[model samples]
Target: MAPAHRDLADIIITDELAKRASEPPDYLREKLAFRDLADDMADNPKAVLPRLVRLAMEACGAESAGISLLEHEVREFRWFGLHGALAAFEGTRTPLDYSPCGVTLQQNAPVLMKHPETVYGWIRSAGISIPEVLLVPLHLRRPAEDGGAGTLWVVGSEPGFFSLEHVRVLTELAAFSSVAIRMIQAEEVVQAALQEQEQLTREMSHRIKNLLAITDGMLRLTARTATTKEELVAKMSGRFLALANANQLVRRPFAHDTISRVGLQQLMETILKPYERVSTKGLDVALGDHAINSMALVFHELATNAAKYGALSRDEGQVSVGWSIHDDRLEVTWNESGGPRVCQPETRGFGSTLIETTVRRHNGTIRYSWLDDGLTAAIILPLSSLAR
Candidate 1:
């Protein structure tokens, strides 16, 4: 289960993938074959490797050919693409420790082994024979001398069936396979980015529509509650500005930083601390990795209402926030005291609607109690949404 690396230090991988000192066999024919495959790759990158493996077989005159990529995660070499005799075994895997492909990588050059099946039991178990297999290290992310990747291999039907000419052909093919793998990987990355951008555009459009609806609701509430036209104008202007600021903070990073999540304590500071007269305790428990935008706006509305009508409205009033962990949920309480006598509003404002909408979006529950001293809002969010 070790690399056949005895005296492997004697070999130089620096120029192994380069063209041979002498001309390759059937130079014009091989050139035509590779040029055709290059065009095919531009059309369908996913199919390029298989076609390249077929070309490796034809140019090297091997019975079977394949490309085995090292899956370092699982410590195995997977037959990524193949052609000829062992095509049925495509997608199969062999232990990296025991694979000829691994030896080729460690050697950092083409490895020709005669009757290797006797040493590798897995090959014998597959009910196929590898009398002679020429494996060339594939230079993927780095050259073979530094950190090679996969292997481009060709198998002959009998011992002494391969030669130096076969090795030259396969080494070039191995270089080509490396390029193909990177091209395919690059295409996949570009595609994923495009899809993410499209999703973000759609999401932004939907949020804008929701914000408009919330704005409309706020306008109706402000008109109903404003005592004078001048008062209405002042309140409307401030409220519109606050909404704009909250919208800016609520925007989430959609790139690699999407893994980040915010907690209620941080959310409160981000949206409430600017107005002051608010404090918190016992909010150190773990939180669900919910979307911070909705919860952020929720706190924004709540704090706005408090400054206008709740504890924060009076200099003597105080608001305390705290939370506790339950079996499968977190219960957070926002308690206010020392303001005007607590009483439920006769009509619900857009602020209340906004709070309810945001809480529900994260599968959380919220309730408001109009106690004798002040208003207490208790919200519970499911712990199941934890990132872990």
Candidate 2:
């Protein structure tokens, strides 16, 4: 998805989650400090998990920092928070045997080691560069026999970086974060689980909403089909399936991850597959992985409608789906001919609704004109929205 469309509502909602994605946690201390009082933080561990972790990173004097959680299935270290580091590491997991953090975690003890010569063997394999390194384990309170209290902290840096004093200060800070880490981790687990439930609920709701809408459409078709409603309903159901299939292309578990770049040719082929028997003889559609999902949905619906009523309905129809980049904007035009004359839809229906609504969301423009013999829709989408 383009960076701009990454801010879509669906993406925004999930972005608020407390996953242990890799990021330096301490980068947001000032903001966290201002947002909550010490008392409030004390009262609410989950509320301050991000802040506490952020604070811990600041104390360590590390340019990049992150939290790692044990994945339930494999017991591997999964990064949760990150700061001043590569974003690609977000949600990426490292093997327990492969990670130094994993070593400290398993021993339930902090391992402070900084040897440039021996370090590259393990850390470099993870694509992380560090001249010196410190590993601290952040732990929750256990029975007195289970190593009473202390959190392990891991610090890695370019060679010859941290002095003993720096490690000392980091240790002191970890003392405070240790307590906070336990509270925060427990709270995050509950919150994350609850968040998953809520997301499932919302997705189920969206599915139910789609089902009801289709059911209602089917009922309407049945009522009107006293003579041919069944066949019409069947066709409509197939069309709806096509729409759903198109949606699946744009709908991912993570909204920000949706709207991938796809070739124009592939988009039309998928949507037009159901109606290719009637038309598509001379259609030429080509696109690089430049198209986003929202735009693709609009294209899909347009093609579906064309196949059912306009240019694609006759043996003489041809569709040319192509787009050209112009001044940082993309202009995709769909031209069709060789079919019966097109009559503008009498009343707006599902296809029109999808094209208009989805395009408008991304600040795109859609213009449909019925020519003497066929239909053409010119869609202009800001290149900024489709930019990676």
- Among the numbered candidates, top TM-score falls to 1
lDDT string for model 2 (1-388, tens) is 1121211122111121223133344436545554563555578755454555555556666655556655547756666655555335656666666556655555554444443223334444555554344555654555244332323343445434444544455554555555666666777777777776677677558656755664565456445533575766654665566556555554335333233445445556677676664333222333322233454556666776777787777777777666777787777777887768878868777557766876776678899889877888888877666552
* Displacement of the residue 251 alpha carbon in candidate 2, Å: 4.2
Clashes of 2: 31
Model 1 spans with C-alpha error above 4 angstroms: 1-24, 72-75, 141-146, 228-230, 237-246, 249-261, 281-298, 313-316, 325-330, 338-373, 380-388
Inter-residue clash pairs, candidate 1: none
Candidate 1: C-alpha lDDT? 0.74
Position 271, candidate 1: lDDT: 66
Over 67-125, each residue of candidate 1 has an lDDT whose tens digit, in order, gives 99888788888996778899999999988888788888877878877656556777767
Q: Give the Å error, residue 212, model 2.
A: 2.8
Error of 1 at 202 (Å): 1.3
Instruction: Give Cα distance to truth, residue 108, candidate 1, Å.
Output: 1.2
- Go through the candidates in order and give each one's C-alpha lDDT: 0.74, 0.56
